[model samples]
Target chain A: MKWCTKDIILFNKEKEFVDTVVVPLVPISWDKNMTATVREGEHITILAREIEHQLMGRMVEAPPFTYLKSESMEERMKRLKLWEKNIKESGIGYIFYLTSDVDWNQKNHNMLDMIWLPAVPLEHMEGKARDAYLDETVQDILKVITESWQQFSE
Target chain B: MSNKEHDVTRRQFLNYTLTGVGGFMAAGMLMPMVRFAVDPLLQNKKTGKMVSVVSVDELTDQPQRKTFKVKKVDGWHEFEEQKIAYVFKKKNGDIMALSPICTHLGCTVNWNDPAYPNEYHCPCHGGRYTKTGINIPGTPPPAPLHVYDMKVKDGTVYLGDAHPRGGA
Candidate 1:
């Protein structure tokens, strides 16, 4: 389910059935890596949307967790842990943290399932190339997610 | 050599005019969308509106996902929302369209995923359905996927509401 009013109402009633959440962790860098930051954010947003589309009814996509590029890892994680705590408290058991930022993975890390992938530029492609890339990537992500579901249930 | 036959006499002109106008009026009355055209001043019943999604010839044995928009009236608000249906040609040479929403939890199901080839696979809870929309036993879906009310007009496939086969 999407993070929208209509889906929220459905999510409220059907929260028992939907136990998973996909959170796109996006980084913002204004002074440097501006273009790259935007590109990664765009890809993460689209990828998260496609993932939510494929996994709708079982998972609700939370709003992206955005933070500054220069922010300390401790500060960023402190903020993320709050989101994780609230989400888990709200009855969502599984949280898949989708990110193109490698920094999140390298960090000592919070409890969020940080799914880090190298930020690949999707801006140059069009038509079938873009869709093919997205499809292949989403398939791989879904595999990892389903595998996680198997183990995470316990 | 046939100038006399090509020429329209007064009687023939009146006969053609009446037939053409009468036929047009009759058609406007009988069609679903035209009930109001026939009698807008009387009571208006909500008719099942069918939207043209694709041509019948374009459908193949492999199911193709198609999206179409419908004007939905919700209380005082009337708005349009896009809907998706998987359309395919059956073995018996009939066009079939099924709703993609999984019956178990409303997630979109894909046709012929690598994990579940030749069947609709719902990645959410691993729901599986046969090619004909019947849910596989032991899967999460309790009933078969809903089938769209369809019509073929001038080789175009027009789909109405998807009616669920209530039996599990």
Candidate 2:
């Protein structure tokens, strides 16, 4: 019965796998002091290991509207490497999840979902869609997504 | 006068002894106050002075980072170059200035971050603001970035430490 339990889905949209990444989910190093939560929304932590796997093309889409904070490209990559190393050494699955009111599937929403990628370098995120995963200067886009999702749920 | 010749006057001895003791006590009491008053006047350092950070020609309609220095006096020494950060732009073709100092903690903010793209970033604390200097509440920063009050005379931009962000 325990083995029959469903694997927690990471993404809403399932794309054909580039490869079957069955590597055991490892826990990540998260600062207990650092946390964020929206009113009646999800609390999530994006780890460095997941970032590495995502960048390596092993994983598909990152969680919709993940927020990250970083300064430069080299530093971001270095953080990813460190996150990956932490996961490997700890043998504790690094990736974790939090469900939020914001739905990526919704047509148009007007609520901002903060996806904090604290370790990712800022310079690398420039002009990239992944930049949304970082602290957005203008959170209007994410706001729309969250609002839409909230309406859908109701 | 035969055994012990004593011509010393009592008045002279009393006067000499009292003057010596009085001078020592007076100096002891006055030392702390003298040092206290003189130290501040002597050691007072300039926090920062108003300086021209950008010129009209240098500032475009788009926000651009401009670096300048102000002489900060410390004690007897002078800080020849204290780096000050600002965002320069010409809104409606009129030159304007924005201070990069975050309203929350006074940390210098950078205008361009490849990570956040169009947001200004504070490294000391995770303070962030839009290009237009609006505060994003709930983050580490409590308020928006400050805009330096300025005037354009002929062509150059002059700045003062008048915090005008969100009426700060």
Candidate 3:
């Protein structure tokens, strides 16, 4: 659900049903790969919004966990783990770390599902092509989500 | 100049006419500007303009999802948003359109999911609704899915916003 007053109120009332949270990982960098970083951020952010719309009844999108690209991996992990802890304590069964970063995908996340899909340059694509690309990507991610749900239930 | 020359000075007459003409010109320029400034405020709120979505003859006993564009106004900005409505006909031959948004936590419900046959199923939390969109007892959904305000024209179906069939 969205981070709005109306949705938040509803979330509280129906917290039991909303058992999942998708945290979008956005990397911010104004240095060498600044343009690429911005593009990746846009890609991941748009995907997060679409995913929220698709599965909004079941999950809440945690506010994006944006970290600087220059920061040490150890420090970033430490910070993110804290968010995971808080969310778990509050009764979220499924925690997904959605990103377009290959580095994050390579890392070992025990409980949190690290979903990494290559960033598509949607801004450069036409409307039909963009939708076709986005729909395919969203469907792929949704397959991962539902499969995981089945595995967890089993 | 001969008959009414005593009425007023030449300077006074010119001053009155000049000021009157200048005032008219000023008002003419200001009028459009004033209207433009308040044009959005003066715009009528088109709350319920029914847009025809699909033809009436195509609807069957089974519900079919139709997509339409809704003009959404947010303060000064206005844009068209894509929306879906599920239309079907009852045994009595009357048409009904239901919004897919689940009443429980605002999730989209699907018609006849593989897991739940012949019923609307919420994939999120297992909420179930009957063919008529009534929430089953003990389900997560507390109320029935909303019905779209609908009208049937010559051969087309026009739909407005969905209104809740309120219940605890």
Candidate 4:
């Protein structure tokens, strides 16, 4: 369910059923060349929202963790691990890290499954084309999550 | 001369009293008219309104997912909302329309997913329900799927607002 009040109340009672938590990693670059990074952040947010919408009952979307682009890799990883530990302790068995940051490698992460998507500029496109692109991306993300779930169950 | 100036003219007093009473009578007469003008705006607009979805002849025992657009008014805004319902004909000549949303967490449930054949399966949390939308106990859903208010008119089926069932 969503993080909204109405859904959170229901999610609280049915927390056992929700085994997955999706945390969106948004990167913020304060430098002058922040346009591309900002665009990537927006894209990842939309992707994460669509994934949560597709798998609402099984997944709860945690508030996105915004990190500075200049932050060290070690520090970011440490923060992510702490977040993962807290989420796991709350009864979520699966944790998904969704981001458009190509620097993140899923193989390096032990506790969370990372879905890395390349940054594609969507500001130029609108209406049907943008919707179709987003839909395809959402399907791909769902497939990845479903495969992970299958592997986990097996 | 000062006392005479203080005394009011009889015709002026009569005119003042008549105008005050006339204004009251006019306001009383206009009150209902003003209410009537804005009555619809003040009333609740979300009352269940039936909208036709499909024809009776096309319905089979197997549930068919039908999407229909219904005009919904929320406060000042009015728009058409696309609603989906699983419509099927029962063995006893009864028509049933079930909402596709799972009661567990409001996820859309599909009929006969790969893992659970012949039952409505929610892809989100593996919640399953019977053909009649009754939630299978021990599953994630706490209650049964909602049933839409259904009506048939001239061989066509129409659905109204859906209500959640109390129990399985």
Candidate 5:
């Protein structure tokens, strides 16, 4: 479910059913010349949106956590941990962190499931190639999410 | 009467009459626009409009997933969205159209997961519901799967809005 008022009402009423939360970690850059970083940010946002659309009934797409490019990794990690704790306290059973930021070290954050995707320069790609690339990425993420659910059930 | 007094009275009368006529004309022009804005909001949201989903002959005892597109209005924006439902025929010959969305968390539930035969299984938190869309208590689900308002005509199945059944 999306983080909209209508969906949130349903989520609140059926909190037990809404167990999975997917958080998108996006990196923003203040540098004017960092067009690549900005493009990557847009790409990750699209990827996250696609994931949410595909698994709408199963997962709540939390508002994205965007960190500045200049921010330290330690600070971002700390913030993520806090978010994770709060989500868990709210009775969420499964939390998946989706990111296309290469600088984000998934190894350090073991508290939540992290899906790291390589940044694809989508602006350079065209037509069928871009669609195929997006479809492939979504499928990969779907596989990971399903596997995580399977593991949780067991 | 003096000429100035007579002129002043005529001007005042014209001013009052013109202002009143202008106000009435503006209200006349605005009435339909105001109604147009509020009419949709006042109309019954449940129009009971039905859209054909699948053919009755295609349905079996096993629930099958069917996807259909429907136009949805969110405030001023209107767009078509794909909706999913699980359709099946009960043993008693009644056609059942169950919304795939799990009542617990709004996740899509799959019918007849190999692990749980004859039941809808939610992959998100392992929420389960019986074939009849009744939630299995003690699980995560707080209510049963929503059942669509369904009707069959000439072997074609049509569905309206889905209503959630409180927990079993």
Candidate 6:
């Protein structure tokens, strides 16, 4: 029932502190030079679970999730199996990390504001095959994110 | 007023007005120059720049390192040739494109090195990109070499600027 300028602490059905999240928060996107910013006093009435779900959705939307590097022995093996099966599965791969000043899940005008995901077909053993996979992966990712947002809003 | 004083006043006023107008007109002419100087600040200069490689037919999927040039357009001027490298492929009768610029530091990368046959090596700073353009972090490159946007028509490949690796 109480609120602070920056974050709001929500009480659960049991009157226990369920979650404390920054207010007026925009999740990080996959664009460059994005800063995680918060206002001192902004509040919204929403379940902590909903926010967490949205946050995870945003994180899933971030880049590097769909990138499958075949150079790694493990990745190579995974791709080999996928290639053999010819079945498509989705996953995330992080090859490098950079220190960001913003919240890792903030959304901005461009996805780069939070994370830069370049989805490629992770199973292609060859270059063109990989490009086609990338094209498909991107299309699928966009669809998933769009559907998630619509479902969350509803 | 004395005749000489009157004449001097007239000339001085004319000189001041003429020079002032001339200066104003000159500055007006240089508006484009001013904009040129300050435009980069207001613009995101690093977005979606295309680096060209070879025609799609010249590059093969077997991983050959081919060096080429991209004719870049800068304002009203065009640079004849800017060096670039790429790997090209025909996958199931489809053309695909890749860049040889190391994702780490924009260095030209070599593929299928006899010494390090398993990896793509950058001799400049010992950075290594995988055959698929993944930057091995411990190496010099901070990221992967970019991939150029491309289209194939009649077997000729037209490339766009290098975009961030993965999918950007």
At residue A70, candidate 3 shows an lDDT of 89
Q: Which stretches of candidate 4 lie over 4 Å from their true place?
A: A105-107, B1-98, B131-144, B147-168
Q: What are the per-residue Cα lDDT tens digits for candidate 4 across B1-168?
A: 468878888899999999999999999999999999999999875658899889999999989988776787788999765567999998898999999888877777878767788799887767899998888988888888899999999999999999987746
Which CAPRI quality tier does the interface of model 1 achieve? acceptable
Interface RMSD of each: 1.7, 16.3, 1.3, 1.7, 3.0, 18.4
The positional error of residue B81 in candidate 4, measured at the CA in angstroms, is: 8.4
TM-score of chain B of 6: 0.57
Global lDDT scores for all candidate models: 0.86, 0.45, 0.86, 0.84, 0.82, 0.44
Write model 3 residue lDDT over B63-144, tens digit each, in one string: 8877777899899999876567889999999999999888877777878878789899877777899998999999889899
At residue B123, what lDDT does model 1 achieve?
Answer: 69
**Interface quality of candidate 4 as DockQ:** 0.43
* lDDT (C-alpha) at residue A27 in model 1: 87
C-alpha displacement of B116 in model 6, angstroms? 1.2
True contacts kept of each: 0.75, 0.00, 0.58, 0.58, 0.50, 0.00
Question: Which lDDT tens digits does candidate 6 get at residues A7-82?
Answer: 2222222122121121221233343422221110011112111222322212211111222121343553354344
Candidate 2 lDDT by residue in tens digits, A1-154: 0011122132212222121111211122234523322221221222322222222222222222223322333453355445445534534222322232233213232231223322333334544344345334223322333244335445
Clashes of 1: 0
What's the candidate order when arranged by decreasing DockQ? 3, 1, 4, 5, 2, 6
**C-alpha DockQ of every model:** 0.44, 0.02, 0.50, 0.43, 0.31, 0.01
Residue-wise lDDT of candidate 1 within A101-153, one digit each (tens)? 87876766755678877777888897557767877788788878877876766
Off by over 4 Å in 1: A108-110, A152-154, B1-89, B95-99, B110-119, B136-143, B146-168
Candidate 6 regions off by >4 Å? A1-154, B1-58, B73-77, B90-94, B166-168
Model 4, position B127, has a per-residue lDDT of: 85
RMSD of each: 11.8, 17.5, 5.0, 5.9, 6.7, 21.2
- In terms of lDDT, the poorest run of 10 residues in model 3 chain A is A127-136
Query: TM-score: which candidate is best?
Result: 3
**Rank order by lDDT, top first?**
1, 3, 4, 5, 2, 6
lDDT of 6 by residue, B68-127 (tens): 445656788976443344555645655555666655434356677675685777643457
